[model samples]
Target: MNVDQIILQSVIAHRLDTIAQEMGAALERSSRSPIFAEACDFACGVCDHKGELVSQLNGIPILAAAGSFSVQAVLEKYTGNIQEGDVFIVNDPYRGGNHLPDIGIITPVFHQGELVFFTVSRAHHGDIGGSVAGSYNTRATEIFQEGIRIPPIKLAVKNSIIDEVLDLITYNTRNPQMLKSDLYAQIGANKIGQDRLRTLLDKYGLKKVKESIIQLLQQAEDLTKAEISKFPAGSYTGEEWLDDDGFQETPVKIKAEVTYEVNQVTIDFTGSDKQVTGFVNSSLVTTKSAAYIALLWTLSPEIPRNSGAFRPIKIIAPPGTVVNPAESAPVTLSTLHCASEIISAIFKACAKAVPEKIPAGFGRYCGPSFYGIDPRNQKFYVGFAFCCLGSGGGKKEQDGFPYMAPISNYGGVRAPNNEANEVQYPLLTLNHHLEVDTAGAGEYRGAPGIKYQVQFYGPDPSIVMFGDGMKIAPYGLGGGKEGSLNRNQLFTKESGNEWLKSKTAPRSLQPGDILTLFSSGGGGWGNPFKRNPQLVYEDYKNGYISRESALKEYGVVLTTKGIDWNETKKYRGIDYESRYNV
Candidate 1:
């Protein structure tokens, strides 16, 4: 903590940040999937030799969480003397990694031939070997069907690729070139971090760097405890549901009970549903990461995420449950679906303890429904690019984001106009717009979802719609209203063909047949009766809500020109007592 120590620490921290940026740039430049380069679906980090996270890139949150487990896996497997050029790779959830697509590369940093720390990068590839075209199989029953599962293995030694390992990866994946290039990009990112660490050590010396790491850890631990001290020591429980497991078409529940003690918090998932025969089961590590997402967001949004930030928190999810599934359960889509419920549960728990800081429930899943077809013509044209719409936001001091990507707190980049699915694939664009009245209705209104219509341009083909948020309506908070449900269908204008009564459509889509996707909106905050009349009128003018529906949902009657204030007063009857149940 002396002046010289402070200066050395500052320089080392700066170098760590630079390493993260370099890793991100390498992935962005070399990755093939738009999900990685465009959406930034990747993460990189540095960890102590003991496998504790030291520094990480400001990349995707879930991907960043997996970095800790990846390091631990590599360290546990490598028992021999450390080397200057050893690198490891892992992508199996049972082995404490993320899904197969989120392949992680780890490289150990050495100074004077002594192991000091580890540099790691994880990127979500577009495809891993799976039963479906893309690794995202909506109907996958087991982990074996999802893709190749790589236990801790040495993918690279020093600066060269392990040819046998590379060959194994390429042989398993349908898109070998893309996966191979992205894998190398991750490896290269780690190398940049290694070089930067060496330079810092050479200048500041290894002892100072290690001492600075100790200080950083202490600071993070102190901040987490201070944040938790603000909340009263108590237990809070909340439950949310998934529309259905891939096998069954009925909603499954996930429950969380968070207990706050004197400087510590424990999130227990004992009441969650049993594992199902689908890809929605989550690993213990992924479940812990998802829980941390909500706790970190509420306690201290400004806090840096590393091992220390999690010192004051403990997460427990029983085996065989959706939140924390058994080792054998399929977890390919666990983070995509079950993780959302975990976030919602955390939000619900924090809202009870700190109502002002937490917002009401937002729309949970703005699904990127993945589909594809392989014909005799060219390379497989798969479709996993979907947009956000209709999910509600929490009622913070202000309104929540409409159709926003919740939990992960990310957004989708719209593809170019000419790049329609029909132009490239054997698909036709139908209806693509906002779905009206799909949002949760309340004093603070949740955002509404978007609608899209799809038709086949060629022969009958199969399409998979991996969707959620239908059965469990995004619940409202503190007197807020519940959001609307999701919908999907197959329509045909020629034969007056309309959608069949089904929650999800898994049938083959024939030529001349139409498919409609209805995204759900978020719920509203507070009682609708207290909503501002002028705001209701503005919504009518803005085409968000019709004049009649506004009067019905918000208790605000609108005149020909605008909202009728006097008539609204006549209809205003806020039943906050029953609505909030506080």
Candidate 2:
């Protein structure tokens, strides 16, 4: 190709990426749900006519990577019926969806009557009603109890909204008006994508744009392969476990065997545990998306995450395993686990190959979704306590960020703003501050856990507790100490304060009931004794660690003036000459 063609190719790629980003921005600003508008728990993507992902703006990493699957499902179902101005929606895990709560809206972009591209948006709603008030029904045994499932269907035809379909979906969810408004926001976001993509095509012409996309795809494939070849040829295995399957007393495992040969790689989940009776199962597409993001994290940051980026990496998720469950299985909490265990497992499996790139275990998501009648407005309100979100794992060069949604989110889903949340819900935020001494001890300390309390003032709200990191804390790596376990408790005037389960069906709450959430700290990386004593002293000064922890965990003796290096050396069992070496 000539220089002009190369320049045009770069322009086309960035234009498509910008279009998807615009879609994301639109959704965040217009969506009604706090998770969508405030937390930004959504993803947007632009796809080729064939449903091959071209460019996806990163929102939620797992959700962004899985957008292509939803588009492909729509294409397969609609076939020739797909036309200009028509929009499609799907949220059935069996039919290329992440889960029930994450609904996807797809729109076809046509230029002068010929289909050219697809715009897609997938977002997690606040509530998709099921057996319980919140969607994370731990007692649910089947998908039916998880929530309402919407298969690949036309949400709009020829730019005309289908009122009955909208009514049916909103009718089932607890927050009908919120759901309806959020759905419309998704529709509007996709519409923006369609318009922007059409503008790009008009400027560059269809023929050149098609050539550019082909070159872009090939470029991504070549870049990804180049990165894969860097890994040493070997078959490495790693395993992770959930606290339990919500119902079982024993933990459930998700194992990974990663193989790197030449420029190709394969991830197999042959020996993972079977599907459980709880809602922790991962859908096939969700599994693939999780693996894809894990690989992307270790690969060259420049590699475009288009369809071709995954050409050299093949995923084998065994049927009926926790990685790929049956159609009827409940899978409401799969997204949360992607960061906690699945992605962590893959990172561990490839640690020997990419030691510098892989990070330690992230604090798993262990929050609750609560709903009740708002006495202030005489209406029902549903809210996600993302304030219970944990911190990130430690990296080689940097400490993990505090109070992140999950590792799977990659900072896309930020912690809910306290003031914004209070305005949206009928709850008072009592505390949202970091808890000192909760970070795992290592060369680079893991992020510290936090204390979050919310006192509900409405009548009899139900709280559905789901997620891990309670019984089993985030795992440490490279001789580092493990992070502290998560703790959930309910406080009331009658019942003083009682511990809550990691996974339970549903519990009713009285007015003025305070929910206290103590989230898990991120796992640390490397040995603690090797950490810089001065840095440890700084941590003590900043109140991140107590004086006792500085001495016990880091073997650092804090003095009135500065660190007592002589005492530190004695505590670490190393002489003055050898103190810095280890």
Candidate 3:
């Protein structure tokens, strides 16, 4: 293509991405739930008529369906019957969704009386009714117990809202008003995408606009392939494990074998273990999304995030494995647990292949779900107290960030404000801070872990501990050490401060009960002894690490007179204390 054509294509791509971002803005600003509004757990995208992902906003990477299975399900169910004003919804893991808690809303865009694009807004609702209030079911072995599974179905037709569908879904969840409002917010968000796409079509004409999109997809594919061609052509393997749900003797594994060709890569999960009785089983979409996320993170940022860009990467997720469970298997924990493992395993696999691009393992999700009646307004509340947010592993270029959520989304999800959470629910935040010496030590240290505590004063809310990254800590790369583990405890007069499982059913709580969470720290990158003594002293000075840790873990001696360079040099086994400009 000529310069003019390339310029036009770039403009069109920017507009498409902006449209998706506007949808997310609408969803977050207009939604009722803190999970969607404050934490930003949802993502928006635009797909082509053929259900191929065209453009997606950089939201939650875990929600990287990007019109793959989700859009295909809608097309297959309502292909010939789709109308301009129709809207579809789905949450069935087997059909297209990553799990039951994540509900996807699809809106078709018609231009010049032809199906041209579809807008999607996928969000994780706080309460999608299951056997319990919060959707994370620990003892669940079947899909039915996880939540109400909604297949691809019309939530709206011919621009008319279907009250029945809205009513049905809202009725199942505990907080109907919040769920209903959030659903409408999602629907409205998709409408923005549809409107934006139509406006773009009107301005550029459908023919030119569609042609530009096609060219953009091709350009993405070319750029991605070109980047992959630079990697060493060989097979590499890596694996990560999830904490057992007390039912198993050992942890669950999520492994990956990556094979790199001249211009393509393939990730195989054949050696992974079969589906377990726990809810951590991964759906195929979650597994594929993880593979795609891992590749996208390693690739050039200039590469557009669309389905075409991911064409060079193929995932062979064998059925019945933890990476790709069979139909009807419980997958409520897949997004947080096994999905994170999948990304880490791929990163580990490519450690030798692309050590510069690969970072160490990240601390997984340890947030617990709680639901109860708030005495403030006589309203029911459901929330995943995100104050228990963890850390991200270190990289060659940068240290991991503290208070990071799960590695699946890579902090696409935010930590809800403590003040806002307190006002929203009947809870009082006591403490939420980083603990000293909790970070994995290396040349680049991992983000430190958090110690969060909260007290509930509501009319007896029930809290369920449901997540991973406890039994096995985040693994480091390039000789870096592993990070810390997660721990949860419930303190009440009756229970007298008892420990809680990472995965379990909801337990009733009394008023004035306190909950404490110790989120895991991230893994490190490179050798710790090689780390700069100055940086170590700074960490010690800032109170991010203890003096003993700086001496023992990082081999840097510190005193009131600052670091003793000669002692540090002797400890690091290096001749010189040369300062390297980072």
- Compared with the true structure, model 2 gives a TM-score of 0.97
Error of 3 at 156 (Å): 0.9
Estimate the overall C-alpha local distance difference test score of candidate 1. Answer: 0.73
Every model's TM-score: 0.90, 0.97, 0.98
| Ranked candidates, highest TM-score first | 3, 2, 1
lDDT of 3 at 428: 92
Point out where model 1 deviates above 4 Å.
2-11, 366-377, 388-392, 409-431, 456-461, 492-507, 510-513, 573-582
Candidate 3: C-alpha lDDT: 0.87
The weakest ten consecutive residues by lDDT in model 1 span 409-418
Candidates 1 and 2: which is better by TM-score?
2
Task: Go through the candidates in order and give each one's C-alpha lDDT.
Answer: 0.73, 0.87, 0.87
- Candidate 2: what lDDT? 0.87
Quote the lDDT for 140 in model 1. 71
Give candidate 3's error at residue 391 in angstroms.
Answer: 0.6
Backbone atom clashes (below 3 Å) for every candidate? 14, 0, 0
Q: Which stretches of candidate 2 lie over 4 Å from their true place?
A: 573-582
